[model samples]
Target: MASTTTVPALKADRPLLGIAFMLAAGLLFTLLDTAVKWLTQSYSPVQVVWARYAGHMLVLGGYLLILGWPRCREIMASVESLPGQFVRGLLLLAASTFAFLAFRELPLLQVYVINFSSPLLVTLLAIPLLSERVTAARGIAVAVGFVGVVIAVGPVDWRAQPAALLPFGMALCFALYQLATRRFGRNDHPLASLFYAGLAGALVSSLVVPFFWSPVALGDTPLFLLVGTLGAISQLGLIMAMRCAPASLVSPFLYLQIVWATVSGYLVFGDVPLLETYLGAVLIIGAGIFLATRKR
Candidate 1:
């Protein structure tokens, strides 16, 4: 009885740990967004992404250094789903590419608001991918959240800003990335998962970045480094987050990034989100809060 009770108690803490990981990921995500937005302004999105993955590789190197190559190789060999990790890494790379492209044209707050739709998209993808049950409340909340997205884009004249639609694509990629992470990340070593997250991306970018590369100004070199470090650490945090908690429970915590995005947008870019964005964000946030606070 004691062992059974202890085991269940320990198991219950995983979701909380996942939420904590999401919270940290959310903050780092905001910083990443700000950094990427800045870098993409001066560099090709592809080149900026190359710097990001380059940094990710450096950070991943440090992680492997701590573990030693033998253990790292062993973890790689022992992975139950190396292909899954590879797929997820590609998905994340695609998501980052979409985000960088969108951010070059959109404000941090607006881009993030559109990006917030990933939670809803995750909720939907969870059904088909993870086979999680969605209650009516969740379904309705998802619908309303999307309504907010439409509202945020402006009920009319949305076509005037075609760039606004880019984040919708970004959101879809990110949602799929999140779902893949949750689906396959659990039994793999965090290091292995982290390594593959940037492995394919770095390789692809290394080959292609030269065609699009521009010289980084001396003062702006740090931003290149920042995106890579933030990318690696945040990717690790997200891997741990999904491993710790269900996609449904943790995905909503991502909305917290909106607050950080808003602040960072104003502070870094002196940009304010349009009124429609606030209205749309409220609805999206409300739906998320409902899902997050509901009974288990």
Candidate 2:
């Protein structure tokens, strides 16, 4: 979403620092995805999603406690749109669910290349969902972005690897989530929104996870904790980046995750992306950056 917290902004001259944070955030998220993919091989995707949100809640809960009860209450009071938060949060959970499912069946490079189309989805969705006007440039970019998606999904057997489409579903969910944030986050503090998101994910995942629960080996417990911690830190990095620079300057760096995912996928999983994936990723990245830099 590239949303900044309503906190102190960095000096205008320091956009580089924000760019750095964006790069780091990209790497963290890639690492998080890699971790989730590994965990899903052994546990049900639902169970992995539960551990993710549950751990995030525990981490966020502890941070709130450290902030003191009164400050916590003040943060809670900052929410002007509770239902919007819930809707956005659940949408994210759905995206996360799709992420695990997609990763289980697709290569990391493939999943991320498709995921990059999310900004284009957001642009198309904004017209009806947020009632924002989309310029022709954006509309064309959206079209090109989908073209990139088609290229990325080239020649896949639907019957054999239907999960390949999961990333597209994830992108749609994320597009809706971003719209919800834009619509509802005007009056809500970024931290406040983050809290509500974690809360909603934690509460819901807790209730449903039991039915899909799998026993955790003591050694694998660290992986579960890592998923939660990485999610929190990755989000914090985004907050920091947006605080330090304009979205136009930093949002482009988010694509660097594609590079990181490629390298990580090769080194960690010995998976190499196809030539078509590279071609499609360039189109998707170009389209996303064009949309990001536009004044609209």
What TM-score goes with each of the models? 0.92, 0.86
The residue-level lDDT of candidate 1 at 70 comes to 87
lDDT of the candidates, in the order given: 0.83, 0.76
* Number of the top-ranking candidate, with TM-score as the measure: 1
lDDT of 1 by residue, 1-296 (tens): 00111111124438778889999999998999899998888889999889999999998898788988889888887566777778888888888888888899888888888788899988877877777778988899899998987787675356787777788888888898888776666767788888887997898889999899888899998888999999999988998888887788788889888789989999999998888888888998898887777754
Residue 175 of model 2, lDDT score:
62
In model 2, which range of ten residues has the least summed lDDT? 1-10
Q: Flag clash pairs in model 2.
A: none
**Model 2, range 36-57, lDDT digits (tens) per residue?**
9899888988898888888888
> Per-residue error at 124 for model 1, in Å?
1.1
